[model samples]
Target: MLNFKQPQLRDVIEAPADIAQVRTNLARLYQQKRQLLTDKAHWAHNDAALFEAGASYTRLFMDKMWEAFNEDKLIGDSALIEHLWLQVVQQEHGTAVNVNYADEAGENHVLFAIDQALHVQAHLTAHELPVLADITDEAPDYLINEKMFPALLQIIKLLYAADLRFRSPKETILQPVNDLHFGVKFPDAKTFTATLKVSNNVAVPVKINVEIGHYDVRSFQVVDETGNDVTTIGKPHVSASGTFSWEAQHLPELTNQTLTLTVEAVAIDTLPCLDNLFVIASGNNILMRTGEQVGSFQLELPNKQELGITVNSQDETLTLHYPDADTQIYELAKTYSFFGEWLEATLKTAIIV
Candidate 1:
């Protein structure tokens, strides 16, 4: 109902009444022109002052819009004005305004717009704009119940997924070297000692994690240089497959520490059957035979002399001995074969000093 239209003049003034009407219209027009001029002068002065004061005029305009919207004096759609305010913020600052939904449906568009509007509201709140902040504090009940609640829930879930995928720890602090190997005489239980070394180059103390990959571990213990049982400080986890793993609570900085693993295990008879032997033979250049094929397989010694093979069967196992050392017992189907050459080559290749 607030009108700013200029009064119009009639061309033909027929009588004295027409003259009175003309005077009234002229007075009203004059008052309207004065008001416009005053407003223009006030705007020019304020604009210059604001520029000198280094104030953001766009934010000031947004605050005024919020005021007008609250007072029911705004002439246009409130939602459109809200969208424009957010767009202005997006242009001024680099904050992301829109969330791209996979489905571009009508509801999704509404949600996107609401997201942008809320971000602008948050921006106003962050900058401590008192007018908008106080007005927004009493948000319409419909907006809270219908619009913001669902959107906030979805945003929280998205943030949690992003945090877990990108921010969680992917690997342990200490990278373990592949150095767990045990040498044992066949048909006998032997205790072997191996050292695991880790270097800590950082300034602060770090926890050390030791992982042993070998599966024959019957009993395992970790000790430090002064023969202190370091595994007592941290929990040791052993898998069903006998993989020994431990994590220590403390390791000093810029130090190279060696942790000794004392493992007791039985050998020879504990070695797995043909499937594992095939894997071992495939890498060692040793040929295998099963099911009724028996022949003398000769192997050239490291001294370049050919050693003759004598296969003796006992308890479905073939035992072949070299001059001094007994070879590893290789389990086959219904028979076990011992290869002195393979054992000699494996002892040279497998054992880590």
Candidate 2:
């Protein structure tokens, strides 16, 4: 009998429809992603916004992949993953990605390596996106569907945590040693650079921490042994006081190299001395200015608001004063002189040696 049984109705009908549905879903997804990307094109000048837009596009793309792909197969095709990642990098101008996870409000957040983010922005501004491929991650290029995506998410989480630290404004302070001495370079009233050298005489290696006080300052840097920078450790914290601990190995011996940092002071609280007379403060240091003649004073602040100063201006003489918390009046200087016993003594102690 050469005759064959007829095909089952379920198999003949369901399979073609399922394949068509998958193709339809993918096509719709591709179109929606293209539209989202078109909207993102306008956000080139803004980082956070551009990142958000790119994140939305990534979520759409990933959702389509999940819907169209078989869970038992490799997650994303290598060529397709690279193509999409590169597309996002070129269109959004960075390596930021959305891993399709929701936050407390059920919002998808964008993830990025901040160093890469900064580099991408620089390259985009310079019109040179081609060179960025060398630095970007191809991890997604290796991920397998369902089986490897979880691991990939975990890896991205680590990168996210690191990026948070990298972008934070908190200074890292490692093992504190009393043997450290700072050479401060004062450029102006509120600007200074400090070089810290630790004594190598210690029998054991000591760790040191870096502290960043004012976040509104111009900039900061931490240089390493080979003249390379390790300032990523000095990101500013939201609070006025934050610290980061460093391993002993991270710190170079004092004889080999010293730690250097630059800080620009922003005036926070000011105390009026007299008419046109005021004391401006940057961190714990105060600058008392009397008509172009300025004297620097160090006021150790347990809290910024606890300290107060008053100036009593008199004819042919000006007096610099500070009132302690107990309301006792202390004269900082009685007279203005280019070189006076009181002024010289105060400067010698007030200025960082």
Q: Which candidate has the top score in lDDT? A: 1
**Colliding residue pairs in candidate 1:** 318-336
Name the lDDT of candidate 2.
0.32
TM-score, every prediction: 0.20, 0.20
What lDDT does each candidate get? Answer: 0.34, 0.32
Candidate 1 achieves a global lDDT of 0.34
lDDT tens readout by residue for model 2, 1-353: 00113233223223432323433343344345446656665643566665554444334333333333332133344322322222234344434322233334554333222222222221112111111121124323211233433333333223322222221101111101111122222222254455656456555443444543422243455665567776664443223353322334333344446766555443222322221122223322534332311222233333342222222111112222333211111111111211122233332323222
Error of model 1, residue 340, in angstroms: 36
User: Total clashes, candidate 2?
Assistant: 19
| Segments in model 1 whose C-alpha atoms lie over 4 Å from true places | 1-187, 201-215, 237-243, 253-255, 268-353
